[model samples]
Target: MVVFRSGLFFLAFLVIGGAWGQTMATVDRQALAELESLAAQHPSSKALVLAAQGHPVALVQGRATVGFIGLLNADTTPTAWRTWAQAHEAVFPGACRHGVASFRVDANHLDVLEALPMDRLELASRAVPNLDKARYGTRVDSVHAGLDLPTAFHGEGVLVGVLDWGFDYTHPMFYDTALTASRIRGVWDQYRTAGEAPDGFDYGAASLEPWEIQLMGSDTSNVYGYSTHGTHVAGIAAGGGAGVGLTGMAPASDLLLATLMVDEAAALDAFAWMQDVAEADNKRLVINNSWGLPQWGTPDGTSLSNVFIDGLSEDGVVFVSSNGNNGDSNFHIEQTFTTAGDTARSKVQFYPLSAHPHAWGQNLTLWGEPGEAFSANFMVTVGASTEVNQSPWFNTADGPFMLEAVHVAMEDTFVYDVVAEAAHPDNGRPFLQLRIHKGNTGLGVALQMTADQGTVHAWNHTHLSNDVGNWGQDFQAATSGWLQGTPAYGIQQPACGESVIAIGAYASEYLNSQGTEVGGSPAYFSSHGPTLDGRLKPNVSAPGVNVESSLSSFRDGAYAVTEEVEFDGMTYEFAKLSGTSMSSPAVAGIVALMLEANQNLSPSDVRDILEVTARQDQATGALPAEGEVEWGHGKVNAHQAVLAALNWVSWVGHPTLPDNPTGEDLMAQPNPAQERVLVSGNLSAQSTYRLVDTRGRVWQEGPASPVFRIDLQGMPPGVYVVMAWDPELQTSHTTRVVKTQ
Candidate 1:
């Protein structure tokens, strides 16, 4: 069930954003014509949404929502910025120094604001949801045994951040049983408007104190109760499994929590909140994000979320995200417009992933070449046209009849948005269909959507079949990995960030009968990738299928549980769930162990160690293809990864540097050193030097150095300052060096 922050229904708007240099005002017709041509090639019997490029034009104006803008560097004063936006009738809701801000305006006014000559500003529609769309022990024991790890390495001092839906903080899994104290440090709920927001953040429903959570127990009604996705995810990452025997990968790690709204602006805010908490607590942090934007394919890693991830990565924050479960779903399609009149079209069949299969909606965001104009149509198809299921719009022998249709011409050059939300007239099952007509075709336009929502498949228009294409087995377009071709593109946005460690799922079914063996193959549903930019992902894989973890009070009986136990007079249950969501937290838990081993490991270092220590897989006892697309480096070996982190040296440093002094100073050779950096220059026994990160945390120091080799193997990837002093010259030399690898 897709849940939105209350009171945000009126703040929804379409966001059309491109890189910093793209001209938003320019519209290309040839691109549009090409998309149309691709659409024309598809058959007519199946449902399809024509793909287009351009600013989203309203299909049927229903509601006016809020829009967002990221100022170039946030250089504008609050007063001046508000004045300019107010002139356009845009209401400023919140602003972050990170160059992000939220504003409310009608669709028409938003258009006016978009046309304004605002340099360095990025715009996005605060689109609302269409209502669509691990741990532990038994399987993890194999990983521990494989790596020969010590029992003391239980993620003791590390903090794990969960940027997901609301969590059940009161669960015994998140408390210190001996003292009955909460292990959750803090919570920033963007949906609760009743309390204060976290420091430096102005929005969110409420903030939770650890003590308040301990008092609430199972009274987690402040969060969405429709399902316990967040709760389950958190449990897999760090739950203690108190009364229950189910233990997570890092049961001893403390937690920092935040409940996010579906909006990107809110997500950015939540990221900042968690980072602030981590910094304040002075804890080595690794954050897990299992949620993603559904039905939106942004393989280009230039979205605002990517920007945030990049910025945070410099601060030595580790982020792990799910690769999504669309591996087998037809929610994504990419095809080149080879001929001038050729078209690419598909059937957007909807099948519910929620428990309430009949209630759901899906959103689609299409992108085509610049200056392309494509005609788009959404055709709704229903079951057989009997008395119980009849629709005047569709007419098919097997009962695949159309109920309603909507069409539009996309002239914008960047992104075109469409939503399929109407329920089937007969059975009331949710369905989303599309048909596109491009005037010309020479370039490729890709279509992407959420996988679990339903099926969307491409077919030859002349040979169109009556099949709805919604079956799980046949659903296979929106795969998350890079398409096998030149200029590889296909990492899902947000998760595509360089600093983000995207995780895939390892199935229990793939394991040996003993349940202690590693699987050579990842779960069929785990999204795979060499990102659109050719960056390999997911960095690693972990046990995800049928893993049992803590259950939420609100959803106690919604799903079956494996065990129930009492803690502090309250009953807590352990339930089994699957998906990359489970795999990601398992990795997050392992990261916590890594952090505990070496607090200096940078995000890049964490990713590298995991990949280096990952165990090569031979699915079905067959050697993996040299360039495997799905399994990434390999299945994660918790013991090996942790051991590598324990023995590995840090080579990453922060970005930026202070002014360097010139003349006969101690010079560091190989500025961006990978393993070792040598210190050179005239020096005596009394000469001394020190190397430290941007935060001024010194890592190395040596006395009497005419020449010194500084081991950068222990540093994280980033910029660091080196200070040296010579008693003879009586001058301290400060130089900046970068660490890579």
Candidate 2:
């Protein structure tokens, strides 16, 4: 019985930035000691401390100042203060129940204390998700669609390890009866002695980063309850099904739970306990993590060196993580933020650079800013009444060298929705004419503004501002009605990082009474992609609307994505909240299905299948922007994907096979070119293998190697095999490679 819990019925969350190849470094034993010492300098100190169980304060500073703990407590609660102690009972009766000690500051005096790794504290939100009902046409579209449940679960003997905060072991869904001795099933909790110490992962030793969502506490057992982020993410991996809630991608698959039980958010291993478990239960397969930190904390790539991240991958785990919603809130790829860029426009493009030499009090140029969320080449002119109207015309004097828009055209613009763009629009061409948006923080789209009299340029620190150049000139200044947006200022960089897959939101065809979906689209908050690395993140698109999922049972028990939507003349919160987070899971689930169809399919192989097989029918009927740098391949096609995984007739150098992949006749693509494909009329590449598909798309390409061979996704299903006449890799002798249909 715990008296007071900072966050009950909820567990910690993790961060998986775009580049997940990193993790925490070795703790400077000296640094840890010094931090502890500094934290506990004063006898009255009540600083946050590291403990085996959940973090508990031994002697809280009480209210303000700051103190620290010198040791990692592992014993039961002390009865020094029987009165206060008795009031708070341990939530769980176990060894690692709770390790946290809550108290204010002991004194305001300065006290040398040990400093745990410090990171900026912040909360990130993703674009709501939705299903592609148009492509699917139904909830269970996979049945006859590109990839279905059975095909995806081909990896019945395979495994997937999930690293996150604590889970709800007692939850009905997690306690699937069909698992126990089944071919694909597992559940374990190193944190709690009983039940499933659902959350927390391997944070080596007692090291935790400041911004880390979870921290080491005294009360370890029964620590986590219902974490929205963790639960939602895990649900995508393997959440229990539901009558009203959404089912998981692999409803029948096994689950390996690892939670990082720490207070601070960024600790690599909240404690070695979780790590020890994962190592002992290593299955050499796939692992997904939907957690990461802001790009600012790691200007360099050092953060990608976390030992745990690599160790697991080395042991045969395909690590997956969220690309981060920091584009707007934190240092994102686009220059525009939610408080600024969200508008009633069809597009929300990305900007590359954001530089305010004199305004930001610095000369550095930020490259990860989010800009417009629309078409790069789209332009429009409107009267002062059109919504989402924007014109470069702001300048200093408003506030250093900054820039702000009062009425890009109109008001009420929300999440790319035309909430209020008509306010300034004219009959066709209004006086307040302007374009929608431009630029990505990574790629740096710019607006060279020069103070104009009426629609001049300007800048301000406030959340809202206007174009002030024309303000004082016309005399009627104040009453003249500001021609907002046109900035008469300097240059604003646009299109910074343009090489990656920058994702956008789209709604599913199926709509609720409120026109919502299980996972809808144009997620109001999913930060647009296209990183400073010029890599278009989210390579493809998915539904980002109202998706149904398991509830926290603690935090907002209602539907997850939206507050509530009207369906069939009735209001319901049974569906999940919408966002890219939801969309990503859908894709992840599909990937699992693809693997299930083929045991030999590798991560790369799965990625290729999805990209190539995905449909590219935009409303414009335009093919998906081809290229590995952008759209990768196209929209996901469960039907085609399942077929390809089953047919298993493909090539490595290119996506398409030669005209006749038989044993004799042959044709060459990009014929007489540097890189060409040899389509042997005969399936005679000289490789031996049989491609079998139980449910989803699966294949055995080359001889058995940890990694598999591949070209890209988007392969159609058919009966034909590939014979790789190339080298037999490890064996010096000749070998036969085959691909079965």
After superposition on all C-alphas, the RMSD of every candidate to the true structure, in Å, is 14.5, 17.6
Q: For each candidate, give its TM-score against the true structure.
A: 0.61, 0.45
Model 1: what TM-score? 0.61
Candidate 2 has a TM-score of 0.45
| lDDT tens digits, residue span 1-741, model 2 | 112212111112111121112121111121223334544563333333322111122221122222121111333342322233234332111111123222112223222111211111111111111112322422335532324333334224345555555343323344243423222233333333323232332112222221121222211332333344445555655553533334565555555554433221222222223344435554334555444322111221212122233343333334444333322222111123234322211212222124321111101112111221121111122332232333333212211111112222123221110111111111110011112222221211122222112121112110101110101001011113312221111111011112111233345556568965443223334443333333444455454455555444333333334433333343323335554455555555555555566655554455445544555444314442332222223344555555555544334342433333333122222111122222322223343433233222345455422222333234332433333332343211111111112
Candidate that would win on TM-score? 1
Stretches of candidate 2 above 4 Å error?
1-46, 49-155, 175-226, 243-245, 262-284, 298-302, 305-315, 326-505, 511-524, 556-574, 619-633, 646-741
Candidate 1 residue spans exceeding 4 A from truth? 1-69, 77-151, 177-179, 205-208, 216-226, 336-491, 509-521, 620-627, 652-741
The lDDT for every candidate, in the order shown, is: 0.52, 0.31
The digit string of per-residue lDDT tens for model 1 on 186-256 reads 77665554556565444454445666655543323322343467778888888776745566777778887
lDDT, candidate 2, equals 0.31
